[model samples]
Target: MAGDRDWWFDEAAGPLIRPYAMTRGRTRPGAPNLNLVTQIRASRNRSDLSQLTPEHQEIVDLCERPLSVAEIAAYLNIPLVVAKILISDLLELGDVVAGAPFQTSDIVDTKFLQAVLDGIRRI
Candidate 1:
């Protein structure tokens, strides 16, 4: 799957497809940096995103607030995987900024929260 980035499965073989996983050093406290998960997600998000897509625009807009990948994903009603892709793209484009750790808060929107709960019920 070196060249086929989206090839996540081998259907005919009935085996799990493996994508290349690169590793990098973790960020230290009070350091200015990006996490590997964030980088990967952002790259994937930007790969096919267009300016007109609400999801894409939402990501871009949220980055202005320096929201984490998890926060953005939850806010946009998109899968974490999808949010990661968008975040990675924004990071590469310098559209997203990293910041020091801050106070954690539970601030999920009702619409997104309901959608997530609905998905859980279906599953």
Candidate 2:
């Protein structure tokens, strides 16, 4: 019986809560501009912490140093849509502020990336 139940709650399995449950089944973010490059940061007003779920609070903490929507999703190990929904909730509550998407210069620079890769190879 123990072996039969082991697969159900394996050590490799993640959180018990379904991803949809965290967003209350919301697949889309209320704010439409939350793209992968959009930057998020915690706001000065954190008085509404009690109103936030644990996932939302985690986003707030992660955003303290200004993180991208994609980064937040990666850090939380959740889907991008799920992270966006959580961020949307915090936005509505004034817990976090969203910044403009990361912009790139007209000219591309592959040299910097190549240098870093070479340094890693050397190590």
Candidate 3:
């Protein structure tokens, strides 16, 4: 008797049976094989970040402080992947600088070294 059609059931089923509800198949872990078809599909769906809106430009500007992609994503409340895309776009447009210049001095501050070690441990 409780199986009767109801508004809640209809609303729930709508999302469950939606075309976009299917899982995106996973890539073989660490495999070097890249499929051309998948590349083409991704290219078709990819957003051109270079042609960004004002909001996206704001996000890019926030990334100029040398934060990691994860940090940038957290600051902007966006996915890390999206942040990476924006960073990549900025890099292409010569709006971002790459890795810090290597210092000739072998001396690194103990606290900075410890922080790097801690980060490595988390990964």
Candidate 4:
């Protein structure tokens, strides 16, 4: 019955492969265009995708509607860096397009912060 259970996750079986192994210990991709919120889209011409690994194709399929790198990572249950590497690979293969997200930065208001602090002190 011990053999009946899945061995992929069994540490004693020596069958577990670390997620970073697929990336060959690469923490950062060579691509500089990738960011957490950058959108990815399947290219109109996906012929290049045929030469890629099935995993890459799956990633492309997920990007058919333009999902951000973070969304892809969350949906696939993979690390953010892994998703970036995948996206970078797809970009190199011309199978995916990277789109810029709207840039916005929060401006802190000192008066609002003080008022919130005062309200909290009263409570």
Candidate 5:
């Protein structure tokens, strides 16, 4: 009877591998500072990647150009949490580097605000 069962589900069936399976059920990144705006880029060292899973290797390739964590998630077609986990693994392996996000002081700078206002007023 098992052999006779339908092999495929309907078109709406979800991905074969759940996100948790990809990250081995890791919900938190080892590096806690990786926020949505944090920029990620490939490291120059170029360590051996044969030990990494395909997803991990793909992430390294994706980060050749600096990209925000949110952009990495969008590019990988994975959840934000999963992207973080993958990036954390890459970080531990020294395959990539994460750039700090803008500080609150930079966002609140009076000069930057005035520039924005001036540009808006010109339009």
Candidate 6:
């Protein structure tokens, strides 16, 4: 019951639950609304949270401040796929709002040519 490879067991003959099992081995997100950079914020309709497992609840609590799937995964120390699946559940249940994928828009440097020239002269 407490071994490294053990599964969750309630009864001696009860069905075993794996650690990584998500929505019964589901590989697809319910809404397909998430990406690495997609931002998620908690919604007002957390009524669905009552039916969630602890892991799901943790996700909701963490998203009180908007966060991305990758961040969630890192924070929870779980696989990205698992975080995505849980987030998808929250998305389908209307417990979370998914923003468009975040895009980095930093300006490029204008001094690259000067830097290159400096390096060439040093060489």
Q: Which candidate has the highest TM-score of all?
A: 5
Q: Could you tally the backbone clashes for each prediction?
A: 11, 0, 0, 0, 0, 0
lDDT of 1 by residue, 1-123 (tens): 122322433536421422112101212212224443332222223434464344455566555445666677566544455555555545556545555444334545778778888999999
Residue 91, candidate 6: alpha-carbon lDDT: 82
User: Candidate order by TM-score, highest to lowest?
Assistant: 5, 2, 4, 6, 3, 1
Cα lDDT tens digits, model 6, 46-107, are 76567898668878888899898899888765677778888888887888889975443332
lDDT of each: 0.47, 0.83, 0.43, 0.76, 0.83, 0.75
lDDT of 2 by residue, 33-114 (tens): 9999899999998756867777888789888898999999988778899999999988888899999865555327878767
What RMSD does model 6 have?
Answer: 8.0
TM-score of each: 0.39, 0.72, 0.39, 0.64, 0.73, 0.64
What's the CA RMSD for each of the models? 11.3, 7.3, 13.6, 8.1, 8.0, 8.0
In model 6, residue pairs whose N, Cα or C atoms come closer than 3 Å (at least 3 residues apart or on different chains), thus clashing, are none
In candidate 3 the C-alpha lDDT for residue 109 amounts to 81
Error of 3 at 108 (Å): 6.1
- Error in Å for residue 96 of model 6: 0.7
Q: Model 1, stretches more than 4 Å misplaced? A: 1-53, 103-123
lDDT of 3 by residue, 5-116 (tens): 2322354343222222111222221222222111100121334556764334555556545455456556544444444554554555555544533453555687887888
Query: Which residue segments of model 3 deviate by more than 4 Å?
Result: 1-51, 100-123
Candidate 4 residue runs with Cα over 4 Å from true position: 1-17, 102-123
RMSD after Cα superposition, model 1: 11.3
